[model samples]
Every structure is written in structure tokens, then in C-alpha cells.
Target: MGYYAKELEALLRAGRFRRPIMADPEKLDMASNDYLGLAYKRKLLRRAFERVAAYPWHAPKSSLFLGGYHPIHRDFEEALKEANGFAAATLFGSGFLANLGLIEALVRRGDTLFIDESYHASGMVATKLVRGEVVLFAHNDPRDLLEKLADHPTKGRRILAVEGVYSMEGDRLKREFFEIAEWFDMVMVVDEAHSNGVLGPNLLGVFDHYGITPAPRHIKMGTLGKAYGSYGAYVMGSEETIAFLNNRAKSQIYATAPSLLDVALAHEGFDYVAKKRKKLRKKIAKLQKCGVSCGYPEPEGLIVPVPMPGIEEAVACREALAREGFEVGAIRPPTVARPMLRVILRTPLEARHYRELFAHISEWRDGV
Candidate 1:
């Protein structure tokens, strides 16, 4: 216990420990995943309040199999399934739970899981729990994946897992990579947590964004929080796949089901996203332009990575911007391979904010 305390003190002194922050209304937030600003939108808040005022104000007391499942849960799943073109969908307490349960249940001791090295922490941890051969391929590299698959002499089921939009890098999986997975007869699991409500014509996620249809063996996992401005997660697949999860997935089977309030909020959030899609696209376009103007990579989506080179530089950049009444995330080791400043775009920003941000960056860079 004394050694643990000493290690924690060292981490805190080294600026590695994370701390929670209160929402500052005056500061411009460039760090959050509220891409469309729907999380703080007046409409969604009013809707949530209305739902809470109605019924089930308390937490669902049990897991889905016991007494937690409700009509709203089914309705939410059905709507997501239809929207994403999946035959069935099942809800989870969170994106972490969905990834954990789905991957752990599907892969067995004899199976092989070819996971992208840059997959989310949840999926990474889940792969470790699976009693199988887990091979991590280079991030978004089809050639690397193909070579790895060729080298492995496994006659068991091969599973390929990737993210539709990688959270830290803000890059997406290429179509060629998907083609490689198909050629190898691997079960494809795409986590679209970051792209679900922010991409595609109908906001169905990466499949729709790339104009590709999900195959029968493909499983899609996504969250309701980021772009939907709600909570919980869901997995979309064929009816048989979902049925298997209902009985086999320990995460969903043992955890308390998402409450009525969450279901109502998510349903309302989906509708809100549908209505605001056009305006949100315009915001992304504007943000992309801002990134270019600020001498950063042309942002292809809501997430933008501003290079700061080293850990010290990245921390300095975050602090510099914060001093100017702007709050942006500082990315460091573990979360990413290298240090960089992470910026997330939202809907309410204007051209002047971008110009000012760039000015601050220039000043900070020159030590003004």
C-alpha cells in the first residue's frame, strides 16, 4: 500500500494523472466529443427532463433477463437496426460492455482474432480475455493485415476487428482493408462509436459512409453518446447473432439493463440528429477549413490532431490555449503513440473563433 501511494504521487508530480473538470460556460470547448453540440442542446435537455418527469426515475434494478428489459429498449434497438440495415440489434450498458461481451462471446480458444493495433481500450482488453490467438496488425494497413493472415497457419475461425473512425487519429478504415478481410474469410467487426451519428446520408455509420453494405458475417458496434447526445451502446447484426448474445454475452446478461430514461433520451436524440444532420455537415466543413487555416491536417471529420511534437510541447500548447479561454485536449503516451494536441469540433463555432485560435497558436509557437 505504501509503494502504491508513492507510485501515484510520482505519477501526479509527472503530470500523468487525469483530473475531472467542471464545465466552464465562458470558455470555448475544443476537447469534447459532442460533435453536433446536441449533448448541450436545449431541445434534448427539455426532452430528457420530460421523460424523467414521466416514469422510471430510478435505475433498472436487474439485468435484462431478470426484470430490466422494457418496451423502450426494444423500440430503440429496432430503430437502430432499421436505420443501419441490420436484421437485429441489441442494447448494452455502454460501448465498453458491447465490445467486451460481443468479442469475448464470439471468439473461442481455437479462433484467431486479427485486431487493429489502434483499436479502443475496451476492445483491446476484451481481446485479452478471449482464449484465442490474438494478432495485432498495423493500424489501417491492408498489406500488413494480409501478410499477417498469410503467415498464420490457423484452420480455426478468423476474426478481424477495426474501428470505423479511429478516435485518437481521426482517420477511418479504407475500403481496401475491408476487401482484404473479406478475401480471407474473416468475421468483420467494425466499431463505429465515433462515426455513428456524425457520418453517412442517414448517419448509419461507416458502411453508409463508404457506400458499402454490411455482410452477413459482419458485426457493427456503436455508442449512443458521442453524436447522438445520449447514453448506452448497441450491436447490430443478424437475428441469429443477436439471439446468441442474448444467451451468451456475459456483459449484457449480468449487467443492469439501460433504464427507461436512457432509452427515451437515445430515441429522442436519434430523431434530433436526423433533423440536424444538414446543419452539422456544414459545421464539419467549416471546421475542416479552420484546420487548414491553422496549419493543421485538413480535418476529415470532427476530430483534428494538431501536432505539438513532444510531451512538453503538447502540454504547453494545451495550457497556452487554456490561458486564452479555450480548452483543448492534450494527447500523450499510451493513449497515442506520440504526443499531439487533440481538438474536437462542434456546431456553434464561427469563423472568428478559428482565426483567433490560429492566432493564439502562432503566438504560442513563437513564445509571444
Candidate 2:
């Protein structure tokens, strides 16, 4: 207790210890990534239960890529393509591996990589592996990328990586940046982890909302864990790119594949959200009506990261919220230093629920 006391005390003092609130089916939920309430949907659960029950005793004997490939796995990939209308896609056990594997597989020795300054932590780690020149551009500013690419030599494959919709900011990528990647003849790779089932009317993802389809060199990565209400991720790209990743990506080649049950559960979730996203939009509007300002802005996406000026204040705020039964966490350095507090919005976050949460928030004087 003594050894852990300092960390725990600090978090409590600052208001950052996120109480793992047990989901009270009876209580109105305002905090979660289940944007469309797909996880709780009876239809998806029935499918998931059936699949899991089918394999009651044990998992499949072999890896899906080798001799272990199952019909369900192929079906999941097909469902993903059908949902997003991409040329091809391949699933990963999780988003971390998908982002890390894709970047390391594409960017090589002589290439240059330009990434958004506020990109995900996985991207930052992926940069360390590639023996290429890594340059940081101001977040979401195409102008910086334009200047950097113009100044840079027409070297080996240049790739511009960014989040399709920023996780913390809850903001969508500006359309102007697409032309920047095209002008430089760079590969445009975007991580759509946070937007898979929360952005568009049906959560068809970023492209669906913006109507910007990917060209040959463009690629999009998404996760089923966050808003999709399941586990695993996928990278959507050209057929050649998908093949290259399948054959060349070490993470894919060496790692064990996702469980059959996991894939089935994920597919059920995707299908559930596809049918329910439009109705969920009204719930999102109700959340904003409660005076809980989105960190970025409204009607953009589901994330609502509040930029707390200071770490202590951000930490304190999370603590205060949790004490009142709101399980919000204070996002700080390493996660999102720019925005100290990230407000993640999902469906079922009603106006009255936020009012109750805010009422508790108003009681706090200052954060730790």
C-alpha cells in the first residue's frame, strides 16, 4: 500500500483516478466508446453468443493465415469491405499493431515520413523503427506539409501519415490536406481508429462523411475496438498494398491471429452499428445541448477532447467526475499533452445524463 500510495494519492488529489465504473444497465450511460450502442444490441449479442457457443471448448487449432483460416475470418473482411467500399482490407488483432505494422512495412530506408504532430502514440513509436527522415507538421495544417515537401528532395517513397479523425480533438481532417499528399506524390496513410463507428451517419467512417475516396496510393486504418464496440482493426488500401502487407508486414506474418470468437463478435458489432448509426445522431445532439462543449466542435465526430490548460487541472477534473460516478479520465502527456482532458462522447449520452454529470462537476472548486 505504501509503495502504491504516492501514485494513487497524486491521482486522487488531482482528480484523475478513473473509477472503473461497473456498467449499470439500469443507469443511463454517458461515458463509453459504444457510439451506436451496438455492443448492447440484442441482435449482435445473439450472433456473438451463437459464435462463441459454437466454439465452447477451445479455439481453432491453427493460425488463420496458414492452415487455420476460417470461413468467419473471410466473412469479417468481406463485411468490412462491404461497409467501407474499399478495394481491399486485412484485419489485425488490434489498432496498435495495425498502425505500427503498416508504417514500418511501407516507409523504408531512403524514404521520408511526414506525420501530424498530434498523431497517435503508436505512430510516434513506429517512427523509431523506420530508418527514414521523420518530420513533424503542425497538427492538421496542410501548409506546413506543403512547405516541407517542397523543400525536401524528391527522395525515396515519401509518406504522409495522419489520423482521419483525430482521437483527442474529435475533429475530422480538413479536405485541403488531401491535395497536399497528391502534390508531393506521397502515400497518404490515415488511422481511423476512433472514427470507425462514430463519425458518419452510419459510421461508414471518415470517407463516407467527407465523400473523399482513396486514390491508388491512399490507405486508411481503422479499429473495431473503440466505437465499433469490439476488438481488432483493419487497414483498407489498394489490392497490391494489402498483399504487400500480408506478405511483408512482420507484425502480421509473425504474430498469432485474432481468435475466431473475436472476429465473429467484431462482425456482429459492425453489422449492428451499420443499421443503427442514424438514430444515434440525435443522442449526440442531446449531449451537446447539456452545455458540455465538444473539444473540437459539434457534428464533426464522437470524440470530445477538452483541452485542459494544465495537467494537474485535467487530472483533478477527471477525479471529480469519477467521484460523482462519471468515469472520465484526464488525458495528459504521452497520451495527449496538447489537450489535457479528452471528452469521449458515445450514444446514450443524453441531455439529462450530462446535466447530472455537470452538476457534480460544478461542485468542484479547482483540479489537483
Candidate 3:
């Protein structure tokens, strides 16, 4: 315990130690990634349960390739493919697994993987396991990416990975990235964990928002846990790409299949988002307006990051907000370079709650 004790002490001294706490449901939530507020929808849950109850097996009970792929999974995958305009789709246990499988399988020897510096940690970790050269471009900078691409030439495939919405920064992927990928003929991987069901006129994702048709080289990965309010992930691409992943993606081939109930619930969530898109957009707009009125920049999606001077100030702000019955995230290093209060402008939170939350944040900023 001596070595572990020293590491724990160091974390405490730097004010970066963390521990999960049970959520206080009594408080107004502004912290979670449930952007659509579908997690708390009783009707949705009941419907999902009804659908799953009809199935003989509650869980997949094995890897997707080995007698585990159920009709529920197939149904959801088909729906996702149709919605996102992809020729094929596949499911994974989570976004982390999806990234691991995608990168590990797609990036072979001689391939080059170009990624956004601010991309999710899962994808960054996946790069370490791949048998390809990994190069990171400046966050959301197309010029940097173009320059980097020219500097690093590969005899094999050039893969580009980026997030639709940067989780902590809450900024949308630059539109120029799509053009750059097309020009370079790179296989583009768009992780839409935060942007799916939030951005785009159809509430599908960035491609839908930009009105770009899915090409054979385009791979879109999205988590069902965030906006969909379920706990799994799915990847969509061309038929050949999906077939290749099915054969080579170790995570999908070895890990237990994604939960049947969660997939069912996510299917319902997808339907709900499609049916109530106009209403959901209004809720998002209302929160964005409130954020601007409170002196914050216009949020590209649901996340609104309130910058903090330091770790202590960030923690103090979180505690102060909690005292006022509002729960928000006090994000600190090494998740971010600096500390900040990560606010999720969830649809479930009322307009009055947004006003109060923004007022509190404004006061905190003023004092800081």
C-alpha cells in the first residue's frame, strides 16, 4: 500500500483526485449527457420493456459473431442505417469498444491515422493499439490537418478520426473537415457521441446537419448512452466496411453482445427523437438563448462549458451550485488543460431552471 498511498496523496495535493457519488435525484440535473432527457421518460421505458419482454432472451449472452446476434439487434441496426443514410450498421458494447474495434480493425500496417488532438480519450487510446502511424492535428483546424496530411504520406489508407461535438469544449466539428477528407480520399471516422440527436435538422448527426451524403469511406460511430439515453454504441458505414469489421474487429468478435433491452430502449429513443424533433429543437434553442443572455457564447450543441481559473475555483463553483439544488460537472485536469464547469443543457430541465442556473453561473463568474 505504500506506493498506492503516495500516488493517492499526490492526487489529493494537486486537487485532482475523484470519486463517484450517487446522484441526488431531488436536485435539478445539468451535469449528465442525457441531452434528450429520454432517460427519465417513463413511457419510453415501458415501451422498451414491453418490446424486450416478448423476446426469449433478455441478453445476448455471447459475442455478436457466435450465436448472439438477435432480431432486436438487427432491427435497431437496420433502423440506424436508414436514419443515418449508411449502407450497413453494427453494434458494440459501448462507444469505447466501438472505437477500439474500429481503429484496431481498420488501421493495418502502412496505414496512417490522422486524428483531432481534442478527440475523445477512447479513440486516442485505440490509436496506441493500432499497427499504423498516428498523427494528431490541431483541434478543429482544417489548415493544420491539410498541412499535416501533406507532411505525412502513406502508401496505405489514410484514416481521419474526429468528434462531431468536442465533449468538454462543446464545439461542433469544422465543416471544412469533410471537404478535406474527400480531397485526401481518407476514411473519415466521425464520433457523434455528443452531436447525434442534438444537431442537424433531422436530429441524426453532423452529416445530416451538413447535408452530406454518406460515402463508402465515411464511418460514423455514435453512443446510445448520451442522447439516446441507452447504454451501447453503433457504427455505420458501407456494406464492405461493416463486413470487414465483423470479421476483424476484436472487441465485437470477443466481447459479449450489447444488452437486448438497452438496444430496444435506444430504438425507441431514436423513434422519439425523430417524431419530436421540432419540439426538442425548441427546447435546445431556448437553453441556447438563455446561455447567450447570461453572457456565455452560443453553444453549438447541448454542452455549455463555463471556464474556471483553477481547480479549487471549479470545485467551489460546483459545490455552490449543488447547494442551490443544481447539479453540474466540475471538470479538471487531466481531462482538460484547465478546470471548468461542464453544464449539459438537458431538455428535461425547464426554462426557469435554465434562467436560475445561468444566473448562478454568472454570479460565480463575476466573483471569480
Best lDDT goes to which candidate? 3
Error of 3 at 102 (Å): 1.0
Better of 1 and 3 by lDDT: 3
Model 3, 40-96: lDDT tens per residue?
998999999998899887888888888999999999999999988899999999999
Report how far off residue 343 is in candidate 1 (Å).
Answer: 0.1
Candidate 2 lDDT over 42-121, as tens digits, reads: 77767876876775343645555775666667888888877777788887878888888988888888999999998988
Tell me how far the alpha carbon of residue 50 in candidate 2 is from the true structure, in angstroms, after superposition.
Answer: 2.0
Regions of model 1 farther than 4 Å from truth: 1-3, 49-58
Q: What is the lDDT of residue 233 in candidate 2?
A: 81
TM per prediction? 0.94, 0.86, 0.98
By TM-score, the better pick of 2 and 3 is: 3
Worst lDDT 10-window in candidate 1:
51-60
Where is model 2 more than 4 Å wrong at Cα? Answer: 1-31, 52-60, 292-299, 362-368
Candidate 1 per-residue lDDT over residues 77-104, each given as its tens digit: 8888887788999999999999999889
Looking at model 2, the pairs that clash are 14-315, 14-316, 15-315, 15-319
Each model's lDDT comes to: 0.82, 0.73, 0.92
Clashing pairs in 3: none
